[model samples]
Target: MSQWFQLGLQNGNSPLMEQLTFFHDHALLIVVLITSIVTFFLSAIFVNKFLHRYLLDGQMIETIWTVLPALILIVIALPSIRLLYLIDEINNPALTLKVTGHQWYWSYEYSDFNDIQFDSYMIPTNELEQGMYRLLDVDNRVPLPFNQPVRLMITSDDVLHSWAVPSFGIKMDAVPGRLNQSSLMINLPGVFYGQCSEICGAGHSFMPIVVESISSGEFLKWLESQI
Candidate 1:
């Protein structure tokens, strides 16, 4: 969840999200270093009005410029590639969850369990209780146990939509007639919020996503109740 005036990424609740945050910080540091160095050099040249044709165009300087960017890109690309494989690696999920996007709502199916499915709709403002977040609360929140890997399958019944939960580091598109897959394993217990990221129709902003991360025992209780 985010606070007022907050612009940074949300604190991670999953291992993948935590790794993503680390990568973001790592890349940001390198970017700032490059920007600062470039700015200083430009400022020095402009302030002194110094011009040395041979010194500026030296072979050593050219080689350094070319090799430095390549090194930086390699440094960035390695981790990115590793993370991509990690995210795509869905090995023997403990459970399977299917998410279906509609024009104005979402449907969830716990495929591993029998008769556990429901449609999630946004809680209207007039029906909201005290302390409930507006435009983020749903009538039925998808509950899954923490520390358990779940295979997430996403698809759309109608137009394009996106199922994104920032704290969980999930943002998979829901395409019609095609299924996209992802994985989620929350490391903590909390209620995470999200919304339909793609603009589908008039109710695009009204379709909110809520996920309840709970202990295995509590999750079993909820599962039993749902079943």
Candidate 2:
């Protein structure tokens, strides 16, 4: 979860998010390097007493400017393409969780188990308990076993709503009459929070999403109770 004065992005709980964090740092470093080089040249142009006419027109400078950006793009594009493919690949998922977004709330279904499904509605601020996160907590949470890959299928009931969780690096749109799917694995065990990113209605901010990640043994116990 993100907190006040957080320096960088929230801790990544999924493998894909970890890769995303790495890619962010990698790209930022390149941008910083480019900025530093440009700044140094601009400073020299103003402060330095020496001036050369050849500096303004040169094939070497043009080649450097052109090839450098292309090379940098290739360097960044390779990893980006790999991550896209990785997110798309769903390998033998241990479970398939179906999600549907309504005008305000979210519904989840565990098709791998028999008749296990529920609606998750946000807990009102006035009804919140001590130590509970106001406007972020929900009456029901989508529970899943940690360290196991799961395939998520999403759709919408009425309007467009986006199911987003920052830690999991997932933000799938819930479009009516259309379905979207993604693969992810929670590497850590904890409760993660999100909300309906799209403005479906007036209650958009009140529609929150929660996920509780636990071990497989505890998940089985929860399944037994649900059954």
Candidate 3:
């Protein structure tokens, strides 16, 4: 169950997500510092009657303001650009999974193995067992191996949908007649949950995504059973 007072992002389960969280904190710190400084200056002007006659027509002040913002942007931009490239980098994935979004459910295909495919549907609330998460658990959970690179090819069979998992830091659009791809690597073994980000139709919220990361040997055993 999700906590009621959760304030920040979910604990990351992947390396990319860890980096994303770090970047978020880094950017937020800069914003907070800028806001605090600006607020202090404005308060001083009003409260302390601190007014400089040359403030309005000072070239040095204008130059300093302009240069400072430019430098801050550069500081922010460098890491942002690096993260963008890192997310796009595909380093020879060990497994490839094709995901197709339907009007409500999600279908997954393991192309690396022979004849391995399934459809994942949300388990109704009433049918949920003990310890099952409401509206988050699914009938078919996608199994993946920890520490193994995996590639996902996303598309839609009917309407537009988005495949996203916050802990994995992945959100790719699923458009009909178009295949969008993304790569991910789970750093640990656990169950991560996500939902279709795009608002498709009446049942948009019913389609939930669940990924179960296990050991490579266990993943192979599951794959063999599927075949």
For lDDT, the strongest prediction is 3
Please write out the lDDT profile of model 2 over residues 1-227, one tens digit for every residue: 99999889888999999999999999999999999999999999999898776688999888988999999999999999999998888999999999999978999999888899999999998899998999999999999999999999999999999999999888889999998999889998999998899989999998899999999999999999998
TM-score of 1: 0.97
Model 1 over residues 1-227: C-alpha lDDT tens digits? 99999989999999899999999999999999999999998888889766888656799889888999999999999989988998898989998999999989999999988888999999999999999999999999999999999999999999999999999999999999999999999998989999999999999999999999999999889887776
Candidates in order have lDDT scores of 0.94, 0.93, 0.94
Comparing 1 with 3 on lDDT, the higher-scoring candidate is 3
How much is 69 displaced in model 2, in angstroms?
Answer: 1.1
lDDT of 3 by residue, 1-227 (tens): 14679999888898999999999999999999999999998888889755686776788989999999999999999999999999999999999999999989999999988889999999999999999999999999999999999999999999999999999999999999999999999999999999999999999999899999999999999988998
TM-score of each: 0.97, 0.97, 0.97
**CA error at residue 227 for candidate 1, angstroms:** 2.6
- RMSD of candidate 2 to the true fold? 1.0
RMSD of each: 1.2, 1.0, 1.1
